[model samples]
Target: MGLIAEHNCSMLLMDHVPKLLVSSIPDSQVVKNINCGRTKTAQIIKMLKIEAENELVQQLTKRKREREREREREREREREREREREKRERERETTKEEPEPAVTKKKNYEVDLAILKIIDEDSAGVSGLDMPEIFIDFNNSSSNKLLLLDEITEFSVLVVSVENDLEENILTETKVSST
Candidate 1:
């Protein structure tokens, strides 16, 4: 017979083998041989099916383990990125909060005073005396004092002194107006 016909005959035999064994007389020696062959074929098919199921289960378990590991790696990467971002934000806030320069404190005060001086009627007007604007600077813990001399129809003289409570010297300018 040709190869195709032989294969078909074998397939037909395999299909009928179980039925033939079931219908044969139990005491016959030929039936015992056929039953043994059928039991071996059924055992082989069951073994193959079990092996296929085991392989499939192993593949699925391996894939699940790989997927879990990938997810863990992704989570670690995200946590690292979040930490880096928080560190950068902290650095930015620190840079933005710069220290300010120290400033010295000081107190200021002002006083105004008027003075009148008596002149002798026998004294003539003084000549060749020029009155000019005066500026003085000094340092003291006491208050300032001013003295003015007014002469009748003659030139006037003014004296000013300032006291400073600070560590630095104080500057004072005095201007005298005549009426």
Candidate 2:
């Protein structure tokens, strides 16, 4: 195509460009650049002098090599970033191994808390899985009048049960089940 364009031969403008260049002929940027705007039997652009043409072609090849090198550099940068991320992850794992695990305070599960003045027999502290705060439900379960305090069980049925209490280690007895 370059030779044809150089000799100012007629060229047919193809929109789809089914056939770019003949295998016998070297690819030509000038012919490739032509599009639907260029018509068949049109006058081709004049080529540069031999020395100038060779110089321009060499410059174009150099620019192509530079672009390829730039792409390779960008790929290498991305690879380095990936390695840095992996290194950081490894450092985090190593620190985790060296450092002690965070102490997890055992959560007490209390269904209700009976702050009684006097018990039926001995004044023994009856603890259950339902510990104070979240699970401690204050209820008047004692048969004795000596017990005095706010009964939280009065606010409807608080649904005191062994629900979610995985461990039977703590004695969690409801008002109905309490002896």
Candidate 3:
């Protein structure tokens, strides 16, 4: 429909317009100057439309920048979470590699009980009893059996079989020098 004929354009005041227009157009005749005749009102409406479009463009630019910043923050958070997960996995692998020192005195009759205790502890891990096998080659002529406790520095991880009094080596490595 056309502009409302009943709505008096003259009734509308200049004070309602933005303060920027007040400096350019006199308050008494600002509305009348823009809407001189029926043809001029159309021009005034077009100017207002251009100003609204500019405002919308600025608002859209601001929204786009905010969205970009939010996406960057989310990406940073995801990267940190991945790093934390990797660190945890490394720590778990290290713990598995280095066997906790067992200070049990050598016993003959209680060997089965000791083996059972070790197996029970192993069951708590994710791999459970899945470990490597190792055998003591007593007959190996190259094996140095007379090395002192301090000189014989080696760390080995083994899994004890619950069914039998036997241990399977998971890993073997030379320990760090005590000196």
Per-model TM-score, in order, reads 0.37, 0.34, 0.42
Quick one: best lDDT, which candidate?
1
Instruction: Output the number of the TM-score-best candidate.
Output: 3
Error of 3 at 135 (Å): 32
Sort by TM-score, best first: 3, 1, 2
Selected candidate, larger TM-score, 1 vs 2: 1
lDDT of 1: 0.46
Candidate 1 Cα deviation (angstroms), residue 71: 0.4
- Please write out the lDDT profile of model 1 over residues 1-179, one tens digit for every residue: 11121232345334544433333323331211222355655763454356546656887999999999999999999999999999999999998897767643221122223222332332326565344324333224154365342322323233434443465544444544332
lDDT of 2 by residue, 1-179 (tens): 43333322223422122232222234454443333344432333223233345666887999999999999999999999999999999999999889687754322222323332212212135555232232322334544223233333222224333323565424354441112
TM-score of decoy 3: 0.42
What would the per-residue lDDT of candidate 3 be over residues 50-121, giving only the tens digit for each residue?
Answer: 665676688799999999999999999999999999999999999999988985432111122222122222
How far out, in Å, is residue 5 in model 1?
18
Q: How close to the true structure is residue 90 of candidate 2, measured as C-alpha lDDT?
A: 100
Point out the higher-scoring one by lDDT: 2 or 3.
3
- Position 52, candidate 2: lDDT: 45
Q: What is the lDDT of residue 125 in candidate 1?
A: 60
